[model samples]
Each structure stands twice: as C-alpha cells, then as structure tokens.
Target: MKYILDFDIAAVCISCITLFLFYERKQRRFGPGESYGRIAWTVLLSSVFSAASSYFANALPGTSGAATMATVTLFYLFHNSIAFFAAVYILNYGGLLPVKKTMRVLLALPWAIAIAAVASNPITRLISYVDSANVYRRGPLFFILYLLSTLYFLIIIAALFFKRSHYRKSHQRAFLAAALAPVLAALIQGFNRGLMLECFGASVSALLALITIQNASELMDGQSGLYHRESFIEFLAGAFKKKEPFTVLIAHSPELADLQGSLEMQNYRALVAQVSKWMFQASGAGAAPSWVGTGVFGLLFSRRLKSNPVGDLALKILDLADASWSVGSLHVKVPFKVTILQCPEDAADISDVVDCIDQIAEVARHSAHKKIYTKFDFSVGKHKRSSAVAAALERCLERESPELFYQPVYSIARSKPFALEVLLGLSLVNNEQAFQSEVLSTAEKMGVSRQLTELTLKKAFEWHAANKQELAGIDQLQLRLVSSMCLDLDWPRTVLKTAADARMDLSKVCFEITETTVSRFGNDLAMNMELLTGKGVSFALDDFGSGYTNLVKLAPMPFSIIKFDKKIIQPGLQSNKGRQLLEGMVDIFKRRECAVAAEGVETEAQAGMLALMNFDHLQGYLFGKPMSGQRIVEALKNG
Candidate 1:
C-alpha cells in the first residue's frame, strides 16, 4: 500500500490551488456580484471533493474488507453529488431555477436518490466494486453517473447558447466554454479508457470560469491587459464605498478613425495596443488607465499619488495621449481632448461623478476649443467645492447669469413655431454647459429646489412681460416642473400669481411634468393637476415614453399635451414595430384631444416622421437651441 502519483491526485491538487486562489480573490468582492462568487465557490468545492474521493478508487490498500468497501462507495457518492449539483449551479447561474426553495429542493430529489443508492452500494454493489484481487474500479452502474453529468452539461451548454440574449455576453461565453470541457472529456475518455481526461478537464474548466469571471475582474480586461469601463466603475464604486476620494481624467480621441483609416486593420490594432501601453506608462505609476471607449481612455488617480483640482493633471495626460504615434516612422498625431472631474467637489458621490463626466464629455464633443478646464468662474470659488457648486447654482438662478433661454417648439400643422419652451441656462463657474436636471437635482438635494424653481419662474415672467409686445407671435411659453414641485398644492396658485404680478398672461403658459415625478406622486398629484387644468393651465406629460405609462395611469391625469421622450421616439421612427407603437400612442392622444409633441427632435428626418404620424409640435436643437432672453427678443424684433 504505497502512495502513488495518479491523475486523481493531480486533479485534487489543481482544484485545491484554484479554490485557494478563488477564496483569496473573494475577499475583495463588494455589494453586488457577490452572489455569483458564492455560486462559483460552491461548484468548485463540490468538484474538488468529487476529485478527492476518486483518488482511492484508482488505487487499493494491500488489505481489503469494510475499509475498502467504505472508501470505494464514498467515491461513487461524491461523483453522483457532483453530477447533480453541477447541473444545479448551471440552472441557478442561467436564472432558470425555480422561484420557491421547496421546489428547488424537490428538483434535487433525483440526486438525493442517487446518493442513497451509492450509500447502500456496499451491500447493493451497484456503482462501486472491490474485486477479489483487492483492486477497486467503477462498475457498470457507475456509467449512469457519467451519463447524468454528460446530459446536464449538454443541456446547460444548449440553454446558454440558445438563450444568449438573457445573459451578459461575457458570462454566456465563459459558461458555454466551461461546460463543454467535462462533457467533451467524458466523450473522449469513453473512446479510450486509459486516458485520465475527466479529472484535469473539469479542473481546467473550473479554473477557466474562475479566471474569466471571478479573478480577471477589475485587475485585467480579458487579453488586452488593460482596464475596461466596467473595471473602472467597479474599482471606483469600491473606492467611493470606502469614502475614498479621487479624480477621473477622461481623454477622447477625435481623430482615432482618421488614424485607423490610414493604416491596415491589423497594424491599426497593433498601434492601439502600443498606445494603451503608453497610456498606462504615462499616467503616473500610481494611476490606473482604463479603455472607456474605442477612442477614449480614463485615468483614475487616488490622493496618495495626486493633487486635488485635476485640471493640470488632465492637461498632462492629454499631452501624453495626443503626441505623435510613431509606428516605424509613420508618425500620427492623435487629436484628443481631456475632461477632468474631481470627486466630492464637482460631484458629491460616485453616481454624480459619473453624471458630471458624461456632461463634460458632451460639452467637449461640441466645444470648438482644443483645451478646457473645469474651474469655478464665480467669486464663491473660495468656498468648499460642493458648497461652492450649490452656491454658484443659487447665485446663477437669482442673478440670471445666463437667464431663462427659449427653444421654440415648432408646430407641424402651422409650419411655424407656435410656442417656445423656457429652458434654464447655465453660465455658472467655468462657463460650463450644465445639465438643467443635474443642477435642479443638486438644488433639490440641498433643500433649495423650491426656491430655485420660484426664482427661475419669476425671471421667466419678468422676461415674458418686458418682451410681451415682441413675443406676441409666439402662442405659449412652456415651463418644466418636477412632480414634487408641481404637486406642492400651492403651485397652481403660484403659477397664476407669478404671471398676474408680472402682467404676463397665465393662459399663455404650459407646464411640463416629468413622468418619473408623476408616477412617484400617485393620486394626490393627479388631483392637484386637475385643479390646474380646471383653471385653464394646460399641462404636458414630459418624457412620456421614458417610464411605465398606460391608459389606466394616464386616463385619470389631466394632460393636454403628450411630449414623447427622445429615446423611445428616436428608435420608433427607425423601425416599423417601433413606428406602429408610436402611431398607436399618437392616435390615442389625438382621440383624447391632446396635442402631441416630440422632445429631442434633432433631425429633419425625425421631424418629418413625427409630422407624418400627426404629431402637433416638435422641440429640439433642430428648431433652435435655447437662447438668452435678449436673443429671443432680438429674433422677435428682427422678424
């Protein structure tokens, strides 16, 4: 009874190493995605135990009796358990498992029966055998164990492949590839008995799953050896959870296509690979560079290795990125721009930081300047960053640094602008193009949104009165109100008073309410809305197609205008099914005597499509970008 090195022992060693590494990596997972880790670890442990027990079945002690019988039968039991539970893991990961815990347990009944049979096999001698020669091997009944595992693996592979849309593509590929290993190995081994393929095959597949999913993580991006967008977000989310502050410098390559177009695809790929490596090297040793888009790179730096106010750092990184790419004397200067956002300064949280960066990117895309830095333009810059932003917004609202600009909503039936939406202008610190929603959100979070709204409306009324003679051609002035603000039970009175006090007509104003605000407010808001409608204050459902809306929800509400959200409308204009859906909505609204408007109509094609669908109004950059009150007055005077 000398111990020997065999395939099973080798398999056990490999599985043990994989599990050890897996548990080590498991220490870092946070919040979500922890469930996937639990599933993977469970599958690994079951596979490990299965491999461990198989060792004794491949060998025998010089003595044979109950000890041999016990050891051999345990192997069959572990193998049976592996077969049953591996399928369970697959079903669970694929989200095909039963909802009820009792049903799930019932589903495991067949595996339990197989385990019981193996347990009683010492007398039954069904799956395991200790022959007269004192050597142990799998009996004819053991083939059933392989059959079960094979069947399950095939089913799992087929399920994942066929239902590919249900899963993340990365996860689907990994599971499909991993599931193929053991089943394929079983088939190969069925042809040749001497090949110890199943043990190593299963171990390698498990390791593949671990590396592809649980381990590769934020540290690596597949084979590129660079961080990806998801990794950057994951890493930053973890950092934010720990209250760790940092700056993100995003660089977008505007001329990446031009550079790639000049070269062969393979050479361009190689050039990008070199550029990625250069980015990592240039972004300071402590900084992490992630490929956020095909032509964009993001460098994340913590306080330990960087300074606050990352404008200078962003310029430096851009300098590094925009330099000439010398590939065998073919130098290509990449035209790019960098957008810098400091956390807890520009944004209070990770979500806000993401939003700020997105807005900055939008500005950068439209900006004619080669370089732009986000620094405060207001005198309140000396204050704390978050406070300064909030104060700057308040000051912007009160003083009308930019003021309420008007974007005319073109009426298709009239073939002219019948109304103009009063969009709040942003000319705060840095003269940045601030998102209205974000600014108002900051105001709301700071308990000043109500005051801000009042200030904005008051300004709008003042401008409307001064230009009332000039703006007589324009029929209505649309203003936006959040559900909370709209349903405050006093907004209806405030609307009438504000207009009356300014000597501006309340009959000419239409208030747009966001769907999210409406859905969140329930019946109380509907009652308040009806009160406004009764007073001749026309209401528009803003961003209609963005949220869950149906006749049941929309019928009770008092709405005179239905403004289609850009996202749902844009696609509907492109596809027949989507167009039909939009047509149905337009028809329903038309029947209800509601004027249908489409928001974010940026193209002639979009305007034409919506016009053909009998939409009444179109609002977007296509008609006119939101302009200062002076600009609107000038346009009116000139005409």
Candidate 2:
C-alpha cells in the first residue's frame, strides 16, 4: 500500500467493522426499527465512500483521459453526498431531529448542493485538481466544500447542546465526543495538508459512538443481556406492525424485588445471569427471551413452531423456572406467574396487547394457584372499542364528568343501611362500566398512576361536594380504591387534598382494600395506608376470605372492617359446616375490634342467616343494587 493509502485503508477497515458491529448488536428476534436500519445503511455507505474517494486523488494531470476525469468526478459527487447524509443520520441518532417528514424531498436540499458542485467541478476544477507531477491538489472551491462539511459537524454539536436536557449524561457525552472527533481531525489535517485525518477520525468516532451510545441494544439491561422494557415495547410494536401470528408469554417474579433487597448486588447479578441462562436455554432458538422487568422475562415466539397449546408452553416455562439454583451458597427457587396472549387472537393493537398482558400478569402474580392463564382475549372489534373507551374516559375527565354510583351496605339488625359504598367506575363508549380500565392500568405501568388517581379523585370529590346537601349523612360514604391507584406515592396526598376540597371529614370516610391488594402488598401500600389511618380515615378489608388472604400478614393492618367476598360468602351460605366456618371467621375479625359485613346476600334466607350470625352489615342486591349517586340519595330519603 502507498503511504497515501494509510488513512484510506484504516478508514475503510474501521467503517466495515463498525457496520458489522451494528448488525451483530441486535439479538432481538423482532429485528431493527425502520429509522435504526436506515441510519445503519447511511453510516456504512458513508464510511465506504470516505475511503473510496481517497483513491481518485491519485489520478492526476498526466492522466487527462475523460474516463479518469469522470471516475474522479463521480467519486467526489458520491463522497460529498455521503458526507451530508452522515450528518443527518447522526442528528437522527441523537434524537435532535424530528422523525416525521411530510415532504422527503425537502430533506434532499443539502445533498443537492453537494451534487451541483461535483457536477460543475470537472469544468471548473474548483473542488479538485491534477498537479504538474500528476498528483492530486485541492482547488480554491475545495475550501467551500470543506466549510460546508465542517458546518455539519458544528450543527450536530449545536443541535445536541440545544437538546442536552433530552439525553442522559452518558448519551450527551458520547454524542458530543462523536461530533467533535472529526472536527478536531479536520482542523489538524487542515493545518498539515499532507496528513489525511478526517475520514479516519469519523470512522473511529462512529465506533466510539456505537460502543458508548447510539445503540438500540443499549435498551437491554446491562447485566442480564436481555431487552429492557423500552426496547421490548419497541420490539412488540414491530411485531404488531408485521401482523404475524405470535404468542407472547410473560413470567414475572414478584419476589425479585425482595431478593434484590436481601442479597448483595454482585450475588444478585450472578443469580440474574443464571436465571437468564435458563431462559435462553428453555427458549431454545425458537423464542426471543427478554427481561421485561425486575424478574419478568418475556418470551416471544412465532406460531410456525412445533408446539402444543399455550397452556403447555406456559407449563414448560414454569417447569423450566422451577429448577433450584444457588447464589453464593444460598439455594433459591424462583416462582413466577405466567400470562400468555396471542396476536390477532387476544389483541392486534400494541396498546391492547400491553394492557392484556399487564392485567393477566397482575392476576396471576397474586393468584393462589399460578396456573397458566389464557383468559385475556379481545375480539377484533375490541381494539377500536378500547380506544373509544379510553377517549370517552379522557373526555369524561376533561369535562369533570362523574360516573358516580353507590351500593348500600345495610345493618343486619334492621332493614336499614349501615353505610353507602361509593363506587366510581370508568364508563366505556358503549356505556358499559370498566372500573379499572386498561388505560388507567397502562398509566400506572408508565408511572403516571399518580395523575390517574388524581383525576379519579377530583371528579369523585366534585360529585360528592355538589350533592353533599342532598346526600344528607355524607359521613356514611365509603370509597373503594383500586390497589394500583394506592400504589402511587402522591395518592395519599391527593386523598387529603381532595377531602379538604370537598369539605369532608377524613374520619367519616372509609377506604376498602381487597384481599388481592393485601396479599401482594408492597411498601407503597403500607405507607399509603398509614397516611390514611393516621388521619383517622378508616379502612375495610374488602373481599375478606378471598384467595391468598394470609391472616398472619394481616395482623398489623389498620382495618376497622372486614367484608366477606362472595367466594367465601356464597359457600358459607351453602352448608351448615360452611356457615360455621363463616361464623368462626367473623368471630376472628370481631375479636380484632373490626366490624364484619357479609357480601353477596342474594336471598332472604341468606339475609336471615347473616343477621342471625351477628354480622355488622349486609351488602347485596337483596338490600339495594349499585346505582347512580342521585338514586342512592333518593333511596336513602325513601327509606
């Protein structure tokens, strides 16, 4: 190789390697994103021409043949075109530029400028020249091209600096470094014309940017080597767009958080690695296993596989995870909940799929038996229905629209009521009530649970304040809050603020928490409950004796009431022995100074039995079905 080919050969080799690394980085089965794939091709082609353009300089004045001149002209044209293309890609990668383009031709202006110069360069020789020694020399107009090229570098830095707040510190540093690398090289080579530096510098800088940042695989968890939530969602979106028949199985270990707290970080990482290895091995090339959350791994597989039903696939994953592994002499068995959903079957849209998975995962996580669940299916029409529901709900909130309803909890001693349980639910477009909506759930998953809770509370408080006078005894109002809403750190404060705004006594308000919430209790729940209980706001253990109601864990809870779930109540109302069990549970709660209520009392016989059992309250259609706030008030007046 000639001494002149040193930088050119180095640039070509580095560019080729960078391109290979870019392609090799994606371990996802879903493939790269459109923008990501486009940018990769631009970078590869740009780097290739950066090296190729160097050779045209060797064809000099002695080689006056039109063929040589044409080759040199074409090389510079391509070289300059790629230069501008690379700058645009960098801007795109840095997220400093907008993704949408109404007119793609509008973006071609920079390339057009470069091409016009290259087209005119042969007649003018402004961009290049053949020296007397048959060597290449820079023309006067070459400085203008150089200026435009360097301007791209400056634009990248300026754009990134403007949007510095949008990026993480590491990303900001990497991108700035990537931009500066070529500029500094251009400056050095400009001072010493014999030293070729710009192409070589840009190639190395790209490699640095690839390794340090500007990588999609950076979406993977650093330790686990699996897709993080953001990347997994991106992968999911691609799958949805493809409309390919595929099954997504999510395994979430609620215990992972606890384990992370208990073990050393290094030991925890090692354990995660072991679990990931199991996931990969179990997947066996057919499925792309990704760590979606703390201990949640999602396996995505196309339908064209040798497989049984989704239930069997879930079972195999469960059995696969059941294997015991040790982390620093500590033997651990990871028990996880499996929730599976199939595309175009369960859901076709990305949002519906996410909502379905999240809802099913939540149910399975707290379930008494973590059986393979496949019940989360939506018809083709349901996607539009769900979107309409979300939009209707959003409109409802914006208008301060209230969907307030109340179920009467009656005193068993008389036919009169003990309290009215306020039930505010999201009304769908079809006027069907979905108390906990997928939109709300998605908000919770996205950490906007606080805002969702605030919106619900705001409307509820508004309705209550407006009807306070008509509602007579407002103190008898009890609210049933979703567990996910309570998990928001701001929920406690929101409750206090709403209560103050409504001019309601906190002591008179009661919050009912279901067994589902209590069983899967976290620190957020514990803290929020304390905030309420501290203000003399009463709590009722709603759906008591439901699945996973661990009485031992419930010991320290500040519950003033216990309402028996229909699962417990119906069976108790069935047999004499079952009735005895019910009485025994009532006695246990009474001993703890909690008022006990029997729910689902649909019969006069059941009502008599509940009354005889000394249950403090009875709630069922036999007393009064849930109705609008106005009807509830009218009913109270009539009674």
Candidate 3:
C-alpha cells in the first residue's frame, strides 16, 4: 500500500509533465484548434482524472472484496478513458482523422463507455477483487479483461506511432518515442511488479531530455530543419489556413546535366549543397530548406519578414557562394535566380504557387540576363496581351473569329490579278489586343506552333469552301505555310486528308515556304514538298531574298514561284545593286520556268520598275494592302 501510493503519485506527476510537454511541442508544431483552449483542457482533465483514480485506489482502506473491487474498477476505467482520448489525439494530430461531428462522436465513444461502466454498480464488481490485506488485486476475469483492453490501447498507440514515423519530420520520432514509452512500460508492468514500467518511464524521460539537448545544439548551429514534404505542406497549409501572409521562394538550378558539364560533377554537387545550406541560414532563424527536385529548392517564410526579402536573400547567398561555373573551357560566373510568389498575394492554393513559380522560371530562362530574379507580376501588359491572344485563338475553334485576307499577285504581262495571297486576320474580342509577332515565337516555345498554323490553314479552307465563286475566279490562291508546320508529318498528312475529304482542288492552293523554313528543316523540306507537289499542290519560295538565301541553295529545290524579299524590292527602284539583284533573280526564275513576284512595292515607280524587270506578279501597297475577300472582290470590280 505504501509503494502503491508512491507509484500512484509518480505516475500522476509523469503523466502531467509528459502531457504538458506534448502540448508545448504541439503548439510550436501545430497551432491552436478552432475551440481555442478546449483540446488542452480536455487532455488536462483526463490526466487529472487518471491521477485522481490512482491516488484514491492507493488511499482506500478496506479488506472487503467489494471495496477493493470498486477501487480497481475505477482505476481501470480512468486509465482506459485516457487511452481512448490519446488515440483520438494521435489520429487528429497525424491528419488521419477529419475534424467533423461524426468523427468526434466516433473517437469519443470508447471514452464515454468506459466512464459509464465505471459509474455502473454491476460492471465494477464483476471487474475487481479485494485481497487479504485490504489490498486490491484484479480477479481472474480481471486479468483477461485488462489484457484485452491494454492490447487494444497499445495497438492504437503503436499504429499511430508507426504511421507518423513514415513522415520522418523533425520531432516526429521523438513524439512517437514519447507516446510509445508508457505503452511499453505498462506491458512490462502487467507481468512484473511495476519495476520495468517505472524504469522505462524514467528512461523515456532521459531520452526526451537528450532530444531537447540535441535540438538546442541544432538551433545554436542555425539549423531549423524539416526532413519530409508533408511537414512543409502542413506548415504552409497552417499559415495559409490562418490567413497569414507568407512568401514562397523557389530556386531552380540549371539542369543538373547542364551544370555538371559546367564544372566537375562532384564540385557542382558540393556547390549546390553549400548554396542550399546558405539559403536556409539566410531565410530566417527557423527556415527549413527543402530540396524539391535535383535542382530546385523551396524556402517558405512569413511575409512580415521584410519587403521583397526573398530577392535580397537570393542575391546575398549567390554573392557569398561565389559560384564560378565553367562549361567546357568557357568560364561562366553567375548566381541562381530566385522566383518568388506570395501567399494570399498571388494565389491561395499550393498548386497555384507551384504553377506561378514554374511560369516565372520559364520567363527567366528566356530572359537575357543571368542571376536576375522575377516576381509574379499580374499587371504586366505583355503577359495579359499574350493570354488574351491565346484565349481569342481558343474561341476561333468554335466561332468564325478568324477571317481570310487576300493580297493580289498580278501578272505583269497580263496586267491582271492572277493569284490571291491568303492572309489570316483574327477578330479581337471586346477590346482584346492582338498577339504580337512574338506570340508565334511563344507558341513555338510552348510546342504549339504547328497546331496554331494548322488551325489558321483550316480556317482558310473553311472560308474558301464557303466562297467557291470568289476562289474559282482566281487563277490560284497562295497560302503561306509555316516551315515548322511542314516538318510536322502528322499535321501535314492530316491536312492533306482533310483537303481530299472536302474535295478541295489541291492545284488551286499554292503553298509559299519561307527560305528560312527550308534551311532549318533541310531535306525534310524536299521530301514533304515532293509529296504535296505529287498531290498537284504547287509550292513557291516565300521571302526569297532574305534569310541566308543563296542561288546554290535554291537551284536543286522544286518551286513554282520565286518571291523577292521586300528588302530587295524596297531599295531596288533607287539602288543599282538592288536593281541588279532583283533583275538577276527574275531572269533566273524565268529560265527555270518559275514565275517571279516582287513584294513590298509602295509606289508607282517601284511597281513600274518591277513590271519592267519582267516580274510575273507585283504584290505591294501600290496595288492594295492585304484585305478581306469581300474587299478584294470590290477592288477587282473597281479596277
């Protein structure tokens, strides 16, 4: 009885201390619940009851079996009640249990039943016995019932401990150890004279003390580290859930292969690790640096830290690392750029933060300067314009927003519009600005240029199909083909099949290929052109004089028409060298039985000069700027 009193007091003291420490860690790890102080109060109340039951059982004086039965029953009920609550706590803290009324009811059921049974007269007597010295000893059935209850409680605690271990975050192992200590101790005490349980509890206390010391050492070393992704996500979610402003700075290294080639591979990795360490130190006293990918690091901090602090921190770290990278023999010294997106400033979701950073990284890659960081700027007019253009293009698939514009290609000898050059005009929605020329470049970078070109061609075909009479009047309608589109075998094959399905005349469609497209795509050009020409579609060389154009390059290719670049024609009317080059190009095309067209003539003089040089077509502002099909028909009527 004397030892029982000591054991009860010690158990109560240890329980209170552990619970207090657990809660303190929980607050630092996870914030308060919606009920504010309710969780802590409930846990404290359960501990008090457990402590009280232990005290009363030790203090009770009676050899009467009925009184001993009553004491053991109360103690068992109190212990089980706390066990149930601890299970619920672990599940909730691990994020396995949802915070709902139904979940709360389910978690509270075991505790409620235990409380009711302890208060009931019949069950209490059935569960306990009194020994000869007025001491409480469990009955034969008591051992069985206690074993089952203990096993069940230990199973719950063990399940939670293992489940949480997989997370492997800071303090998770220590928390698991703390939760497991009492369960292991109780299992030992059930067989032995409570000696092992007491020793285990003391050992756990020592281990916890050691952990605290290690944490303090890490803190002194300026390392507040998190080892898993879930912890980072939970941390961010907590900050965002509370509507607290924060910033997420994502630093992406150049591709590892790219970096590896720049310097010795080992040296590069060492440099990266050093930079990562520096980033954590610079971010804050408690910043956790996470390596999200081989070359990507994520640092999350409170927005109240400073104004544009991520940018400043990134620059400072880069400067200190002194990253001098060499690719082959070329020495390139630069800092890694940091892209920052603010929480509740840029987006509410973590996924959106990731996407915004990805877009910023893409923009940074194309930017010319090195070591320059970019923040997500929703107000950038250029980005808005590009988005509007992409949206308008999407709408074009459903409605006729894109119209066909035609430029007349006149026959100098015939003095008539022999061929029509089809141009694409996108109808802007509302006050939406059209895409700049770089929009096409952007699409190419996004791997959608071929699709955009095919869409344009399809729109042209749809227009031609609707206006058979206008198309029939023209000797030929020339459509400018993007070189990239020709290189796409699947797209070109699809276009051919579509044209065949529509019963469109391939002879009426003259595809003008830019010289650069031919140069870039090379032999694929020759092969695709040969297939289309075999299908009775004529091909012309567009932008002839520009883009590394050489006679040697043009001699072996099959082209029905040769169009002089605007650069050659614009100055040829006044410059002798330009005039000679224009005449020479025309003569060469004539000898090859290819018609020649002069582009960009703006005056009657330029037009007359082109006509005199035996150009088969005169295409420029002098005749008319590219206009809609209806306007072209009206021009034809007026002329």
TM-score of each: 0.42, 0.58, 0.52
Candidate 3 at 473: error in angstroms? 4.2
* TM-score rank order: 2, 3, 1
Q: In model 2, which residue pairs have backbone atoms overlapping below 3 Å? A: none
lDDT, model 1, position 368? 39
For model 2, how does the per-residue alpha-carbon lDDT over 392-504 read when each residue is reduced to its tens digit? 56675568664667888888565578677876566676766666446556445455445555666666666667777766554566776776775557777778988898776
Instruction: For model 3, name the residue pairs that clash.
Output: 63-134, 262-326
lDDT of 3 by residue, 456-563 (tens): 667666666777775566777788777568666655586687676666778788988888887787766777778878888898998887778766767767899988
Which of 1 and 3 is the better model by lDDT?
A: 1
Per-candidate Cα RMSD to the true structure, in Å, reads 20.9, 8.8, 11.4
- The C-alpha lDDT values of all candidates are 0.68, 0.69, 0.60
Model 1 Cα displacement at 486 (Å)?
3.6
Worst 10 residues of 3 by lDDT: 27-36
Error of 2 at 578 (Å): 6.5
